[model samples]
Target: MAKKQHYKHNNGAMYLMLSPYLLLLFFFGILPAIMGVLEIPKPSMANANGGWDAFKIVIHDFRFGPALRHVLGFMGIFVPLMIFFVIGMALMLDIKHSPWKKWLRMAYIVPASISGAVAVLVWYVILQPTLSPIKGVLRYFHITESSQIWQQQNLVYILAIMAFFAAAGNWILIQYGSLQSISTEVLEAARVDGASVWQTAIRIKLPLISKYIVYMSVLVFAGGLQIFVEPQLLNGGIYQGIADSWSFDQLSYNLAFMQGDFGGASALSILLLIPSLLGALLVIFKTDMFEGAQGHIKKKDVEIVGI
Candidate 1:
């Protein structure tokens, strides 16, 4: 009877500890998500027929398809490259006996401390048409009279590169943490068994860290989907080659603030939520990550019969 009362008291304390976070999530996360799906009038409803009609107009606008395509294209180019580079750097840093490892790790993580918007601004200055370092190089080589790299479609690739440079450091830290959690004894046994570094990485390290890789991939993909500040700050938030609404987040921003169509923005926001929610579900269910079932299967059955 005393133990039962003690257990109940502990449970009450635990609930009290969790109440703040639960309340915060309820008000900020759940409430906003529910409100986003609810039908609301556009601020410009008087000017544009009605809320539903305003939403339709925004959806059917000429820029919608092209903007979505541009964002998707940028994600396609950036996410995979960042994942590969971050994982590789993490592996390199995970070498415990390497010289200068501390400095190398610090260098990799330094970019993560910088804000995304600030990083974009710095890159914009570096990649400007006239004062760019590349421009100086080209001029020295007599390659062209002016720097036109930022004017062409190639600017998308440059933007992707800048994003990778700014964000890859944080991902490298995540991957490194996962790598460090792996058992050193297993690696030593593999080395004693004459397994080469490449072979061990492929067969052991990669398999062990597969779940972390998947998690990072999903997280980065979702983040890439919501990209705004980098492109907006870099391109001056105009409808130029890459428009103001190039990303889904930017689309919602343009609808609500620029066009005064809150209903349309909410609809677009709900659409954006779908991909992120689906990606999260996939990470939770489709992968062996959350359940710790990656490589725990044991005992394969074998049958022998008279031939």
Candidate 2:
């Protein structure tokens, strides 16, 4: 009777604790998701036509192909490079007792606190060709005389660097946390067997932390797909290199405000939500990410008869 009462009390406490999150999920997450899929009636079409023409038009738009390609290209370059550099930096800093670890970690995390816009502005100053500090060095070696790093062709590289600078530090912190969670006894055992640091890292540590790396990679990839402000701000808005509807988000913004096409904008917004939704699903279900592998293990006793 006491155990039954205890269980009931625990169940009530759990429900009480979960109520706030349930409320938020229903109102914010589930509601918005449902509304996003529903067809919105447009003022312009209320009388002219009552059909799915707006969504069909957005689906067949020429800008859709180029915008998707551009965003995917950015993701291709940004996600892998970000993961490699961030994980490498995290591993280097994970030698917690090393003398320079504190300062090195500090340097990596400092940029994460700065806004993306601010970082882009800083990069613009540094990559401004003639006035840029590196440009002077490049000029000494007879590099180009032009003062623009914001060239049409170089936009991919420029955006990649900007993303790396803005995002790598936060990923490093996540990787570092994962590394810290690893048992010290495992490292000690590898050391006892006279395994070199490189060998241990490759054969043991990396496998252990592989899921964390994949988790961060998918997260960064999703973020890269949603990139907007850096390219827009760097291009000075609606410029030649970056079309008005270069990215999906940019397309939605332009449709809503610039072109005054609310229905089209809403359609674009629903389209843009696809990649993020797929990424989130992949993170949650496709990978053993949120629940670490340690949770799945069970201890069992085996008895041996005297032989």
Candidate 3:
């Protein structure tokens, strides 16, 4: 009877400690989710002329498909490109023979500390038509001053570059840390087996850090879907279409404020919420992210390439 009372007392204390967190989760997470579901138009209201008709109207909009396509294309380009760079840089920095690993790592991560908006503006100045550092090269190529890269067909490339500057450093930091976490014995075994640096990195180190790669991919995909700041800040009113329906988030914003379609904006927002939520769930349940930092690839689990 005394032990049972003691257990009840401990349980009460635990609940008391968890109360604040539970309250915050309810207010910020659960409450907002409930509100979002309420905002989505039901089938009856979706067929109406105005209130919840946003679901029907937005789906039929000409710009809807293009907006999704642009974001998907950007994700397709950005995730793979960033992954390659991140892994390459991480491998370079993680090299046991490197003399300047610390300084190089610092240099690589510095861009991540810069604000996204500021990074976009800095790229804007460099890519601007007349003020660009490469203006002379433009003239050498016989390109007229009336046209610029930002305003030309190469706008997609320019957009990708700006997004890279804003996001690449953070990913490098993640990849580099993952590489560092790898046990030295595994790397030594690979080296003993006559594996070159590239082979060891590609085969052993990459597999060990596979979970990080998966997490980063999901994160980059979700982030890519929500892209608005880079295109909006980079264009700076020089081009109109870059932000009008360039991304779904921007499209939802335009619907809400520019067109006074609150219901439609809410509907679009709810639709976007699905992917982000799914990605979060994947990281939480599918990956070992929350498994107390044990990491996915153990030293014993890796197969030597040359042996």
Candidate 4:
């Protein structure tokens, strides 16, 4: 009984130690969510029955459709491309026999330290027609004029590349660490069983790191849905006919600040948060990411005795 009481006391102390983080989470995450709900029109407001009118206005707006389409389209392209690059780079860097592993990792890690906005801006300059490294090639191909690459119809592709550049390095490092955490004994046993490099990576390593892939995918998708800065900076904000370039978050921002439609903005914000919240919930429920702080199989304790 005394030991159990002591354990309960220790748990209480640990939670007390975590009070700061809990407070931050409450203030920034929970408080804002409550505020967003409160910002909705009351039953006596112009809506007369509550926020449904705001929801209707936001949902029916022409901007909402295009904003949603752009976010979905960007995610459709960006998520897969980013995942492909992240996994590919991680695998290349994890090559057990590779001489340039350290160099490749350093190169990949460099971009992750750059802010997302700054990375996009750098690409903006690099892909500019006259000043770009590929200026001569673009000119030769007649793809260069006074205009920049983001000004073209292929802005979607340009955005994908920029998003990948900004985000994939962090994911690569994550996947690489997960891959490194893989038991070498399992890998050696596969090699002994005549597993080629491709076979090992595809059949063994990939499955082992599936959890990390799923975690990164959910996070990337969530973040991609709320995309704002790249499109805002790229298109110079709120184009009339080209609303597809503006994201939902940008639309919400414009509604709140640019037009002072607080109710409408709140509706849009709640809508935008739905998928993000779902993704976060899925991560929390589906992964061991939050539990016990020990999820990955340790290489040291792994044995190859059976095979």
Q: Please give, for residues 94-173, the per-residue lDDT of candidate 1 as tens digits.
A: 75556677677788888776657777666656655466667776566554533455554664576678778878988888
TM-score of each: 0.79, 0.78, 0.82, 0.82
After superposition, candidate 3 runs with Cα above 4 Å error: 1-6, 42-54, 133-146, 234-242, 293-307
Cα deviation of 280 in candidate 2 (Å)?
A: 1.9
- For model 4, state the Cα shift of residue 75 in Å: 0.9
lDDT preference between candidates 1 and 3, better one = 3
Clashing pairs in 3: none
lDDT for each residue of candidate 4 in 186-250, tens digit (9 for 90 to 100)? 99999899998888889999988887887898889988887777777655632333433378888
Best by lDDT: 4
Ten-residue stretch with the least lDDT total in model 1: 298-307
lDDT of each: 0.72, 0.72, 0.74, 0.75
Clashes of 3: 0
lDDT of 1: 0.72
Candidate 3 C-alpha lDDT tens digits along 1-307: 9999999999999999999999999999899877766665633333355555666678887879987777777777787888888778778777675666667767767777655677666666676557767878767876555444556346556666767767788788788888888898998899999999889988999999988988988887788778887766645455655456777877887776877666677788888988887787667656786678447544343232211
- After superposition, candidate 4 runs with Cα above 4 Å error: 1-18, 42-50, 146-148, 237-245, 291-307
| 2 versus 4: better TM-score goes to | 4
Candidate 2, TM-score vs. the true structure?
A: 0.78
In the predicted model 4, the residue pairs found to clash are none
* C-alpha RMSD by candidate, in order: 7.4, 7.4, 6.4, 6.9
